[model samples]
Target: DVGCGYEAARQMRRRGRIAPQHWPHVVAASRRLGIAGVSYEWLAGRAAMQRAAVMQGEAA
Candidate 1:
């Protein structure tokens, strides 16, 4: 599906084909790679946990 959409856009370049327009695909790929969906709250919590672990000097 990605390739198909890319090819279709490529074929319509003269009509302003949008490159890198497959954001959903990119997000899916990122999620599949064990990437964290981080937010400010999540990051703060994670940092706190890590800091606590480091302060204790044990495996987090």
Candidate 2:
């Protein structure tokens, strides 16, 4: 569940997204889970691509 939550946050951070007020919660969770080597930029790019795909699907 921690991984899923973190991925969700990463996706949400794409496309000029703002940091959530509860960001501390995510940090705490990641620290607790000992998650390492996370790359925000990569996640953002991936999320942007996913968002584009969804948008294209809707348009189609």
Candidate 3:
């Protein structure tokens, strides 16, 4: 769950050109999960989530 969350955050950070507060949460989760690196493919898919959130006027 954290890997997916981190990837989503990473994508959002890139698209918005702003670091999110949750980044620290993501990092902490990554350490706990022991993932080597976040998956780019997973991160890329976050664009869809971002778009959907925006359309719904909700946080991504």
**C-alpha lDDT of residue 56 in model 3:** 88
Q: Global lDDT of each model?
A: 0.53, 0.58, 0.58
Candidate 3: clashing pairs of residues: none
The true-versus-predicted C-alpha distance at residue 19 of model 3, in Å, is 6.0
Candidate 1 ranges with C-alpha deviation above 4 Å: 1-37, 58-60
**Can you write out model 2's per-residue Cα lDDT over 1-60, one digit (the tens) per residue?**
233466666776664442444444545666677876434554466558778988999999
* Residue range 1-60, candidate 1, lDDT tens digits: 334465676775654422345445544555677667733444456557756877888653
Please name the candidate that would achieve the greatest TM-score relative to the true structure: 2
Name the candidate, 1 or 3, with the larger lDDT value.
3
On lDDT, the leading prediction is 2
What is residue 2's positional error in candidate 3, in angstroms? Answer: 6.3
How well does model 2 score by local distance difference test? Answer: 0.58
lDDT of 3 by residue, 1-60 (tens): 433566776886677722444445555676688966644444445646766778889643
